[model samples]
Target: MKERIRWMALHGFISGVSKLGARRGDPQARLIADPWVRENPGAFADECRKRGSLIRCRAAFLTFDHGVAHEVLRSDDFSVLEQGSNLPRPLRWIAKKTDPGLLHPLRPPSLLSVEPPAHTRYRKLVSSVFTPRAVAALRERVEQTAASLLDDLDGHDAAVVDIVDKYCSRLPVTVIGDILGVPDEDRPRILHFGELGAPSLDIGVSWQQYQQVQAAIAGFNGWLAGHLRELRGAPGEDLMSQIIRASEEGPRLNEEELQALAGLVLAAGFETTVNLLGNGIRMLLDAPEHLETLAARPELWPNAVEEILRLESPVQMTARAAVKDVDVAGMRVQKGETVIIHLAGANRDPNVFPDPHRFDIERDNAGKHLSFSGGRHFCLGAALARAEGEVGLRTFFERFPHARLAGSGSRRDTRVLRGWSSLPITLDARDAAMSSSG
Candidate 1:
């Protein structure tokens, strides 16, 4: 009952407010509360942009304009809004009372929710392991993993396979598991936790889903505690072990902090990349012209990956709160106010890209898309995700040149993390198997 009440005070209450606002025709509310918006947000995003660069909704202000979104994301005047900060006093009290004490990825100490000084300390310790050189060194391993996953798909008697299950989801989790020193046997459980907890990043989840998310967090926290203890006793070459040692040498991370950081890494490391690969696979199959372009000019693979990010950002939107009164897009946003930065809309802003909806693998400025966000809070796994996207997609298509969508694929029932839950696909030219057998 306490957990139910707590869930109601936080996710439930906010979701109710947003749903009411959506019914009354608020663009930002519709964007958050409407499930259809998750699947087809372009229209709502356009409506928000049409209203103004910075506009108010019933609960908070929002922006889909690229420039405004960029400013809010990169500016020091704004910071990530702590969970329940925007809630009314009574609800906040209720939420505090029922706090689960689990190391939630959206709560403090996790890079996603914390502010500077602590965020700085935690990120500094964790960033060393994900440096460009470190990520680059893993590229060969990523390629090999991709090949192995494809080999598994090939060995299957049936030509049709769900890319999300068999390929897109497997590559990143396997690679990230290896990077984090998780035992091979434990990867599947982590993946399950990830799928359940993903909705925790979004607003307007059902009470049932919130319950499931909490349960997943509980499971992950328990598992991570044991894993971290093992690392502390005898560290390995993995990123988690390195982080453990680095913290001991400098500003030490407590058990809670270590869980927050490592949990975030383990979850964020693969979750977004899973979406990137799944989205990239669906997009490439839809646009064979670009695939042909990629095949002909293999060197464009990196930029092609960027284009995929721009066109279908894995993370659709994020929020930042004003630290002080600030002027944006010729309007004043007072302190304590929050603004949602619609990254998906910003990526499609016509001001930035010519015919933004059109997917062009050769887009020169595609890297400028705020898909990974910017400034002090830039995605810690950007390099790794890009490497995964480029390697995963390129290797899949290279292996099965005639791969095609077998049927209409189903998108995940998630608002924040956009990707397919099931992407049915047919691998290879139809007669290739017969010819090989002969």
Candidate 2:
């Protein structure tokens, strides 16, 4: 009880300081804590711009300027210390005193939190398996998976189907799971892991949410350990098997690193792809003409997918911490301070993209958007994500060209990710259309 109180007091003090600093009206002191940002991030980004390109939100700096955000992302002066590096001194101490065993188990950071030789090594290991060629080889499987998902929708008696649940949510998990050699019977459990594990990445997860994250990590680790043990002894034609063989052949990953890599692949693969599909469908349905254009010219589906990413990026924001004092966008960001990169805002920057608010599927430069991020931290799964998004969109439109919005959609309650929680859509059945024609 005493430990919990101390922890609460420490967090309360931090929040108090954040609110106090925000009220000063300093040009660099805009608060992103406004709950409204969750619902309308673009508006929040505009507010950040009004304050200055470089502004403070709690302990972090925010930049809506495209150039500044891009530069900070690529800059060696900034690092990803706060996100995935070692836990802070206070948190480490608290965990040590409160739950010693859970402390070490919870503290091992993923690639998102590492730096230097370690980051390079981890990236190389992952890239070896998650290659563009590998993703390309899986294209047929992705297409097949999309068809199966839509076919399930067709079997439903209800005309209005939630695309998020029926297609967007299922396809990516199934694809990633298949690639990882997850057993058919265990697929649902892994999918649940991705769902419950997502909140772990949120900046302001509640106590209950934090507990959920820990539970997910513990559960996943236990499952992965058993799976890896089996794969080590008898390798198969799967990504996990390949990783196990590589670990045995050369520079090896410790048990913790192995588990972390598996979990990363599962969670990251599931979350981003789910959002990409949801966002693309919402955008196309909003402008039915674009869907028609894609259906008519299948070749343009790739460009259409790119434009959707630019307009409604799946991952809205990322952050980097300064390793040393540096001037960015005319503000001196001190060492250990963080800069929040609003990828969605930067994608919409008018100077970088003319008439940015307008969604143009034919926008020639749509490929230049920072949706996949940039520099060293560029998403390793970029090629896979693109392939998934393109194929998923193309197949969906081709299968149900007359699909339309049946009801109001609801957005996910996520501050950093933009996607739909429930997107209700209705597809036209061929028999019904023929009956109506008669």
Candidate 3:
């Protein structure tokens, strides 16, 4: 029965992708929400497990003018996909030349774009900044930021407040700004860049939006350039200063690379974290009983955050390209084909996560979720993202134990970023105090 259902789901997904378009945000959502797909949580996984390697599903969504349509593929068989041939063209261009405008190099970098030597060099260069110890050092600062944000929400009596705008979105932006040494006044401007960069998939760039993004990119680069100049003359104790100093080497990031790195950090640091927070808050609120359970046992906050990420990963999927003609599952994938890895679907795989739909905070495998992804492209800021989420959830429950979703919240239209545009939440100060007191 289960096998039959899985087959039906795969067929439905293929049909939907064929009819609506592979990357269509609305259609993809509909496909994901399909009864067949939901019922066969392990459909793709089972296929991969059975094939003993990557399995390709026959589905072609229309690609952007620059992109090529190909079959959807998955593999639990290989630890990492082979590199060189898999490099997507846009990323290939950036890897070959330094382009600052590619702010959020969410795709592979030249260093990370290929295998071995180059990947090693790029990883070595940026690894120090994102080291676990470095991220851990920011713990107290992260906590303070969470506390400060909660404090600001203290007296608000409105029936509902958009947590996405009010709390979830702001915390990471502020934290990333602090890390990059972005000036106090310029934080909002940098966040504007994040807004423009946060779309689900790259809609072939709109000229107006492109200009706005470019201007913001330029503004940030100019700021970093001045900072780099200052740091060159007199060193400081921050990530920017470190990057500036590292550039003294011959292969250092050029002006464009520097800006791209800075912008990537700023955009990703805030955007992903915001989604994590927003999704976490919405999940907790949807299950008030669980929220109450969490309020009673503060120790469970970390695990709760993990479960939230598991159930509601902020990033739904990311695209990769085939380097050469390869077979996945039973189908042949040609070179230059684009493959969309569905993180959201993978996270909910029933074989891996039992009763996957239930938001079980006490689930034993909570920490193992792929919300931060896996392999070479694992989120560099995973540690920082975790710390921010842990602190954010802890502080929110401590401050507003009775907080509840007051109205319907809207999800961002972008499929890649699966989060609330506005999460209306209400807090009862008196209830919070009573809960704490008891």
Overall lDDT per candidate, in order of appearance: 0.87, 0.75, 0.62
Overall local distance difference test of candidate 1: 0.87
Stretches > 4 Å off in candidate 2: 1-32, 83-92, 95-108, 429-438
Give TM-scores for every candidate, taking all chains together and pairing residue i with residue i: 0.97, 0.89, 0.74
| Residues 1-438, model 1: lDDT tens digits | 998898889888888888898899887778778877887876667766778888888768888899998888889999997778777899989988888788876789789998889999999888776777878778888998998998888888876789899998899999888778899899999889988888888766788998899999999999999998998998999878888888899989998998888888888888899999999999999999988988899999999999989989999988999999999899888998889888999998989998888889988899989999888889988888999999999999999889888899998878878888999888875655566688
Q: Model 3, residue 108: what's the lDDT?
A: 40
The whole-model C-alpha lDDT of candidate 2 against the native structure comes to 0.75
Instruction: Give the per-residue lDDT digits (tens) of candidate 3, residues 229-292.
Output: 6666886777766776776564586765565566567766788888889888887777878878
Q: Per-residue error at 397 for model 1, in Å?
A: 0.2
lDDT score for residue 378 of model 1 = 93
Clashes of each: 0, 1, 7
> Deviation in angstroms for 223 in model 1?
0.3
Candidate 3 TM-score over all chains jointly: 0.74
Per-residue alpha-carbon lDDT of candidate 2 for residues 1-438, written as tens digits (9 for 90 to 100): 753443343343343454566577432233324455667666766666777677765456778788998899899998875332333577546645665232122134477777778778777887788777788877878989998988887788876789998899899988888777888788888877667676555543455655676677677777878887877878788887887777667668988787777777777788899999999998888898887777777888888888888878888878788899999987888987878788888988877889887889889899988988888878888888888999998888888888888788998766667788889987875555676689
In order of TM-score, best first, we have 1, 2, 3
* Deviating ranges (above 4 Å) for candidate 3: 1-116, 157-159, 200-234, 249-251, 429-438
Winner of 1 and 2 under TM-score: 1
